[model samples]
Target chain A: MTEFTLRSNLDAMYTVFLARVRILSRYRGWFLMDIILPIFLAAMPILLGRAVAGTSMEGNFLKNVGTANYVAYMVIGANLFMVVSNSLWHFGFWLRNEMQMGTLESLYLAPVNKIIILGGVAMYTTLRSLISFFLAFTLGCFIFRVNPFQGDIGIAFLFLLVGLIPVYGLSFLYGSLVLKLKEAEALINIGQWVIGFLMGIFFPVTVFPRILRFIAEIFPPTWMNNGVRSALLGLNYFLGEWYLDLAVLWAFCIIMPLAGYYVFISIEKSIKKNEGVGKF
Target chain B: MFEDVESFYAMCKKQLIYMARYPINFITSFAIVFIIILMVILATTLFIGKEETNYSFNAIAIYGMILFMFLSDTLWTIGYNIRWEQVQGTLEALYLTPASKFASLISRVTISIVWTGLNCIAAVIFVYYVFGALPFKNLIFSTIVLILTLSGTFGFGFCFAAFTLYLKESANLAANVLQFVFMILCAMFFPFSVLPDSVLKISKLIPLSYGVDLFRSSLMGYPEGFPELLPVNQEFLIILLFGIITPALGYLLYRKAEKKVRTDGSLGMY
Candidate 1:
């Protein structure tokens, strides 16, 4: 395996990124629908809260979830879900689609590292997720009549930036799963929902039992979510301090990508030897 | 007609075999219901009185879920069945059949509805068992409401299926988006009252609105969450009126769309 120059790798990343942008621009309708999805997801729990609690949401929410800004709480959770969900689906499903389209073998023939090409997709996923996240966040606030720019905005941005790395790592992990398993739709669908459930997209981890809470806390997105909510809505952090949660996300950032890359590489070599990666 | 029955039954058997082929798909669908139910139970329990969130309440939640599931499946099968056909390279062959497209659609929709019905029954039983007693207060009336709900959904499904064929390549996205769009606008979980006034007004216009309301009211004896916007009789009248018009409208619209797609020569493009 010859090591490519850094500039060439960067160019490869940019090329893949540009290709994604062009293809996404072509399907203008799907792009718009994807943006609108998180808002609708957020609306479900928000409306359910309205129907259930009536005027008591502020006080009761504070009691249960540690914040009176229940609207923003759910909006943030759902948007984080959008980010995680889109990365997993887009990166993972795109690989599966490429296999079906017979582009996987061509990609393997390319001189640039597969990771660099994947870096391009990961970059594309991040751009798209961030776009959807803010659009839905601001729009949801306006619709729900909450102040969107309250709390520590800078910390929330920092958490989002840090949290995104591990999400990218996990996307590659997901991509590898598709490469090996060859069933993208069901796996991605089920994976996204299970993430949503585990991440406590609608409720705080405080409501989860010991086992569930432990599971959620270990997952970086769960920490990222709590960090954002804690910053934005003044909710309690998982370990009672803002930096403490950020540190955990940082740890995941290192661990998840390395784990994901290792697993992905091992599986890719095996698939190449056996049925080949394009068998899916 | 006898031949039609035979064809339809054959289609039914085919759909059943196709369904059984994908255990993961069925499990995932079943899991979606469970997850949604869990979300409803957890989120509502946090805000409302425990009594309101108890077993009886679950019965109502299950009803809402079943309504959403039925409508979603009905709409999606109609919309997505085409995508499957196109993928498998059978669209051209299917269109080559002498029978009208609606014959095939009817069988598909019928099979889908049966699956959805069974799923709902399973969910209701699960909810009832876990959540305690289900108040089937007005059994005859609830039964009537369920029929009206399914009929309305079925009518909408016809239009959806035809619209999907017209959509060609974009059918899957349309179905996927509309599934949640209906979930939000149609009050599948909360009462229609929880939606903003503008959204509530729109909900009243939706076909699923009346169906969801009817299910909640008749089975759980839950009142309209927002009665000021729409009175009970007015709502029922609108439902009955739509219940009559949708199938006719759907059939006509589907036929018209079918003709247009056929003429445009886009059916085999994808």
Candidate 2:
């Protein structure tokens, strides 16, 4: 007979979150790298553009990308990409780590619902990613000599806040893949890049071909990225209005988590019915 | 010599077989490279506009990317694989064997060359089709430069493997940081002209930077300001010495680290 009270569930979630925080605290270098890598990632293209277009870089960028501030655009893209990537990697790797350590079975056998545990991990991941995003974005702007304070930052933060749910929902789907595939590192490495490409991390989605643009539009991170850039850099929103664009994210908030949960549950059931979750 | 060759062959076979088992890993690695290259290309177009077709710039980026892939592979495959072995608890068992340890270390280079080489070729063809004709010239000279560059890079990989033995778990962070450091300092995705003067001076000091500059500049037919750090002849001389010297120096450092770890009895303690 397992207890399923609200307080107990909340307590269990907090405990999992605290344990992860303590464990991550021991790897301080990883956190530092998370904050630093985005700057370098953004630098490659900024420098490349500088080398190629030289004096006309800003003008050309404005003509094409809808912003003369190429530095801020790239920086925002890179930082947001990192945030989305961290979400996927952390959630997927959490499940994979448990599977590898042979504790996933024990976890499944535990009295608490698996979603509660996942919720805790998602909370921790969200906190870490948002911190990394803000820190890295600010640090990158300073390094590139771009003013970070420009634009409707509050709305950019709003986009990030609304957009995170679908991203985590996508992570749930990714976690299911890790469970089935049992190749976390390779999959996560490739998965992040695929997501980055689809989201147009370094370029506008309009630059993609028609079909590709349609596909990119359906991805929540694409909307999130465009929304952030629109807010911060004054780029036109995908829908030409911020509220409409955010409404799409709002719709994703309802659909994606449910879809992700359904898929995850189905996969979990199939794997358990076959060889069990501990096999990995 | 024959025994060393046999050991190397066996290790290489084992690695290949292991790779073959994971078909997804193979396919995803190929796809990831293409995605990155395309992403960078499209991103560059955002700045230069869609109408511009600077094939010389394309040549610079593509050639630099090829070297970057090789260097990155050398670091991850050759260097980090040692840490992987330790984590798997096989480092000690392998160390106790009578096989030549150098053969075991060098075997990973074959995998890097074969796998990364294929990826680079596919990327070149893909870029050529999508982005128009790239400037391809001085093939024989570029080949020599590439070989020398790879030799020096493999040496750096050996040195990194040694560092892994010393750093243990933290080597992962070190490798990630070092790769980015190399990317920027070597100006792998851009020309030296884009780097600040202070960074360019530091870049000039690193031997690998010369390898990058010379390899791409020669491949792009040494257009005006192609090899930005120094004259072609001077850069080639530097690469020539680097190619010859680094492997010997790296092997010595690795041997020293191996000896120290063995003496400390921490070879298996990862």
Candidate 3:
């Protein structure tokens, strides 16, 4: 095949990105829900803390999690969980949806490199998830009467923005698995809870057992969550300094996407050798 | 009724096999609950320390989670089963069945209730073992409360099933989102008093709120939440009232809604 010019590749990616936006807009409630879901999720744990500690929770919360602002902590966790949750499920489902819609073959037949299309999806996922996270985080803060502006705003944003790269990378890895299995629901649910637990969606990773905590530290979202929480709530970071944590995420940024793309291409080629991408 | 009972049993068997086939879903459903419970435990204990996590509150949280999860599962299954059928291209065939539509709803719920029932028992044992608190003294009494809670939840589920018929593609999202609302409104993880005045007012309107209180009160070794909002006896009376009335009302509303669909010439709906 002839090498495609940069303009054609860019145009392909833009079209795919625009398609996701337009289709998502048609189901208006889904967009609204992405904003609203985290608040109630955060509320359950907040209420539990209030019930458990009563008058002493403020003092105790500060001692344990390094932030007396438990609502903001949990809200931050919940919003990040939404990001992690959506990145995995939506990316996997985007493929399954295309397969079921009879569009997978058309996608494969397109002359441009398929990574351009996946790149388009990655960009869309980033924009949508961050916007959704922002709305939900702000709403959660307002509802709980916490100061959303507390902590280092720029660094927290830095953690979040840097974190999305590896998060998207992992989603690509997950997408390939879905492509192989042709089943996404069970895997999505399993990944969601597992990551939600390990990432401390409602509590700090300090609470996890030794092994689980070690495992959690290896994941990028764990650093992302702790990084953001540490920056915003004056909480403890996994590593000693903020830059050290960012360095780990930067490592993940380098390795995960390249690794994911490699694995995905291998799976795609093997599937093509056997039957095809449209087999599902 | 006899034919419907047979149909219900067959559907239940079908669902049982489906459940058996996807034991991962079966196991993960409760595992997710266990994870949520762990999150709650970790969150609470992080603030209160392990020892001070309050035995009474733990007991209440366990049963509240039981009811919350049961109602949430039922709400999704009964609400989305038809929509699933529609997507599978079997909805029109289901409409042609001589079996009562009520059988379809109840059978779907029976399967979930069984699953939820087993999950609740497992949850209780797990929570009690972990936390060193089980109100075994209230076991028989709690069973009575559990039965009533299931019936009242069924009443609500029946009402939701009617609306689910019209929600079509939106049924899953609508149902799941509402569960998040119900999670707060029903006081599934906390007392009603913790809610602000506006939400507190909204809490009283939810039938599950009464069952949650009754279930917690009977199981927690004390009345849980705002006793003055409604007394245990009064709450039970209202929930019992809902239990009797809602399915009947739901049946009527569903019929009216179904008639409106045909009359409005919307039967061509996908």
DockQ of each two-chain model: 0.59, 0.80, 0.65
Candidate 3 Cα lDDT to native: 0.81
lDDT ranking, high to low:
2, 3, 1
lDDT tens per residue, model 3, A55-154: 8888898878777888788899999999999999779889988987789888999887989999999988888998999898888888888898988999
- Model 2: per-residue lDDT, tens digit, B87-185? 879999999899998999998779758988999999999999988998788999999999999999989999999998998877888888988999999
Candidate 3 chain A has its poorest 10 consecutive residues by lDDT at: A181-190
TM-score of each: 0.92, 0.98, 0.94
Decide which is better by DockQ, 2 or 3: 2
- Candidate that beats the other on lDDT, 1 or 3, i.e. the better one: 3
TM-score of chain A of each: 0.96, 0.98, 0.97
Judged by TM-score, which candidate is best?
A: 2
State each model's C-alpha RMSD to the native: 2.6, 1.3, 2.2
| Tens digit of per-residue lDDT, candidate 1, span A170-239 | 8878878888777788778888887888788898777778998898888888888889999999888888
The runs of at least 3 residues in candidate 1 whose Cα sits more than 4 Å from the true structure, single-residue gaps closed, are A1-3, B49-57, B222-237
iRMSD value for model 3:
1.5
Name the regions of candidate 2 deviating beyond 4 angstroms.
B49-51
Which parts of model 3 have CA positions greater than 4 angstroms off? A1-3, A273-276, B49-51, B223-228, B262-268
lDDT of candidate 1 at residue B159, scale 0 to 100: 83
Model 3 Cα lDDT, one tens digit per residue, B1-270: 788789889989987887677656776777877877777777778768535646766766777888888888778787777666766677667766787877777888788888788888888788878768767546686677777777777776776776876777677778878888988988888776667789989988887788887777766666534443677678778777777787677667766765676577543264
Candidate ranking (TM-score, best to worst): 2, 3, 1
- Candidate 3's displacement at residue B40, Å, is 0.9
